[model samples]
Target: MDGLPTRESSPGVVVLPGNRAELVAIVRALAASGVPFVARGAGTGLSGGALADSDSVLITLTRLTRILSIDPIRRRAVLEPGVVNARLSEAVLPYGLAYVPDPSSQTACTIGGNVAENAGGPHCLKYGVTTNHVVALEVILPEGEIVRLGSHAGEPW
Candidate 1:
């Protein structure tokens, strides 16, 4: 919340709520606040995707980390943006389950960031980028509409 960088060339910071309902509230406030904001994960983004402007608010999603559920029968996982990529595999290993999309930053990068960038790793040559594995995304549109994008059909959003 505080002690966050807010330089003109850097990004600003704003505290966010911890749960989905609170996230919705923040999104609504952001839409109406007339302030520019960018969502961030582990700050592992190499592209300009996670970068922010001086007037922008950096909505770090690190606090949203969680592995809600993993369905081995369905070979699917319901996860929060803050979940670490490799952690998913480790968490679901006993179930004979594994996440297909694994990036180089799998140990530290949040799954949410991987989704945002469609990240790829060495294994990507065989498995493909993050976009190839994602099913559905519960997203907040620009107008603060929390909508479900994509489907459980393993399509890109």
Candidate 2:
């Protein structure tokens, strides 16, 4: 089950990766074994993306909540996928900055899920969505190859 009450799913395995290294290893093993897997960040969406079938594995990002760095000058942050949206805003408040998407579930939703789906809230009309704020992405491919998309200064596409 994810955020929606009517929705339900059962994964073959549930793994909470403690760090990027563990995550890469898990992904590699799963890929090598030909097991399907889905990455979940906070499991806070009604979209059911976090839900995985019994034949697939659910890789939860909850334990990866570290906010790696905050650059007040660029109003940017280097964060782990599980960093809560509201927490980001709170963390940057002293710098007179904010994570503006602020979806209704900001308190529970995460940067990874937001970035994955380009999330937005009512303020999107004025501030635009998550994509407007994301300058780059560091992703792990299905085969466990790590790649950085986009440039530090702007979006890739």
Candidate 3:
């Protein structure tokens, strides 16, 4: 892992937000303080997408692991960024539902990372990648403003 081509400099600070409010606050404070920051998930991505250089702060989403809501009838689920990719499927298995993005690192990768990388795996040949399964996204802008992209109704905004 350390020898991966995508590996970069180490981060100076690391923070894990327990919830949405805390995540927002941290982003706000970091922005106001003029410190660079990068959002990171399971850190299992082969592309080094989660790497943060020394000048940046690493905001790990591990603590935000929660399946916020699920609508079996709609086949939609709202989850925190830290939720593991495989866990989502496990959670909805009883409802005969599953998230379709099956990244190779599914067991350890987080939904946020899957979204960031638009990850794909063996099943992608039939199911498509993360972007195909993602119906919406609730994201915090660099300035600390939060906004929703796309909608639960499966419409992109």
TM of each candidate vs. truth: 0.87, 0.95, 0.93
Whichever of 2 and 3 has more lDDT, that candidate is: 2
Tell me the tens digit of each residue's lDDT in model 3 across 119-142: 888888998988888889999998
What do the candidate models score in CA lDDT, each in turn? 0.78, 0.89, 0.86
Candidate 1's displacement at residue 5, Å, is: 16
Ranking by lDDT: 2, 3, 1
TM-score, predicted candidate 1 vs. hidden true structure: 0.87
Descending-TM-score candidate ranking? 2, 3, 1
Clashes of each: 0, 0, 0
Q: How far is candidate 2 from the true structure (C-alpha RMSD, Å)?
A: 1.3
Residue-level lDDT tens digits of model 2 in 49-142: 7789999999998888999999999777999998999999999999998889978999999999888768899889999999998888899999
Candidate 1 local Cα displacement, residue 19, angstroms: 1.7
Q: What residue pairs clash in candidate 2, if any at all?
A: none
What's the lDDT of the predicted structure labeled candidate 1?
0.78
Candidate number of the best TM-score: 2
Best by lDDT: 2
Model 3 gets an lDDT of 0.86
lDDT of 2: 0.89
TM-score between model 3 and native: 0.93
